[model samples]
Target: MNKILEASLKGEVLVIKTEGYLNKDLGQDIQDAAQEHIANGINHVLIDLEQSNIVNSIGASIIIELIEQLQETDGTLAFCNLAPIIEKTFKIMGLTKYCSCYSNENDAIEAMS
Candidate 1:
């Protein structure tokens, strides 16, 4: 299930939902999905990881790259439905400083909006 489950715009925010492991491929897919929106000035992004429970270093690195990409647009990246371990890992990787993690998509959307 290394794929994007869904991608749509909610207001001005681009919400990308992913499934399976957050590996390089899936990470790239997420980046690609958001790139167009970011380019068009939809800077706020919410990644719903309710189905993605594991991530490798490369995946995390790509997310870091995405954060950099968003910064160029003065945009932000947020995550929702992160597993406890995934949230801890992002914190340890210092990713939380660049982005935010919410318990669910609604919370993330509200906060981002």
Candidate 2:
């Protein structure tokens, strides 16, 4: 299934909700949305992945790029509601070194704050 990406501003943070597969198109869509917010100086991000189950390499690469960009401005990107398999995949790929994972949005938001 095609991915659906939605982004919204919650005070100083940007909350991104994604569903379906995280493939090339969806990954790029996420990158663009986050980059636009970053350019505008809104840095903290919370990605809700409750509806997403799979993330291909392309999606992972885009996420890495977003992390790099956020790092440049001392910003943080947190992810929440990830499937166990996806969380393990991220850990195995070493993405956990750069980003944080949370069990839910509230935890992520509190931490980002």
Candidate 3:
């Protein structure tokens, strides 16, 4: 199934919740959403990936792009509730070095705060 990306603002952070597979199209959708929020001066971001278990290389690349964008503005991006396999994939791919991963939303929010 196609991925669904839902974004909302929480205080100064933009929270993005994703479901289904994260492929190129959905990755672009995520990127667009992040860019829009950044343009609006909301820099910190939290991505909840509990329901997104699969991510293609293109999607991963898009995430890297988002990280770069945030870093340029000294903003932060954190991921929470990642599936085990996806979390491992991110670690193996060294994404965790750039963006942090949390066990839950509360932890992520606290750290970002």
Candidate 4:
């Protein structure tokens, strides 16, 4: 099942770890979680998608929305541990132009922080 495994702050960045398919529902869940942190003045978001290997178009669009939302506050969005296909999809969707993809959580956190 699609679900957000965890949402927590790692330093000033909000880290959201997800599992299963990244469809509309899970994307919305991720947006909601990030929204809360954004409201509280957190600008950097790191999504750990090690367990989520699938993403639909709707999910990608929702992430586009999330990127816009973060931009409104001068925040940034990032991803880590993405599957090869997912990374390629994001690149094709132009997501890589806005956010970055890291090989692991530590690399992402270190870069974002």
Against the unseen true structure, what C-alpha lDDT does each candidate score?
A: 0.92, 0.86, 0.87, 0.95
At residue 4, candidate 2 shows an lDDT of 50
Question: Listing every candidate in turn, what is its Cα RMSD in Å to the true structure after a full C-alpha superposition?
Answer: 0.7, 1.1, 1.1, 0.6
lDDT tens per residue, model 1, 1-113: 69999999999889999999999999999999998888788999999999999998899899998999889878999999999999999999999999999999999999999
Q: Estimate each model's TM-score.
A: 0.97, 0.94, 0.93, 0.98
Give per-residue CA lDDT, model 2, range 31-93, as digits (tens).
887888898999898889998988888887789899988998999888999999889988998
Positional deviation of residue 10's Cα in model 4 after best superposition, in angstroms: 0.4
> Cα RMSD (Å) between model 1 and the true structure?
0.7
| Residue runs of model 2 more than 4 Å from their true location after superposition | none
Worst 10 residues of 3 by lDDT: 1-10
Question: What is the lDDT ranking, best to worst?
Answer: 4, 1, 3, 2
lDDT of 4 by residue, 36-96 (tens): 8898999999999999999998998999999998999888999999999999999999999
Cα lDDT of candidate 3 equals 0.87
Best by TM-score: 4
- For model 3, which pairs clash? none
Question: Model 1: which residue pairs collide?
Answer: none
Better-scoring candidate (TM-score), 2 or 4: 4
Better candidate number, 1 or 2, judged by lDDT = 1
Off by over 4 Å in 1: none
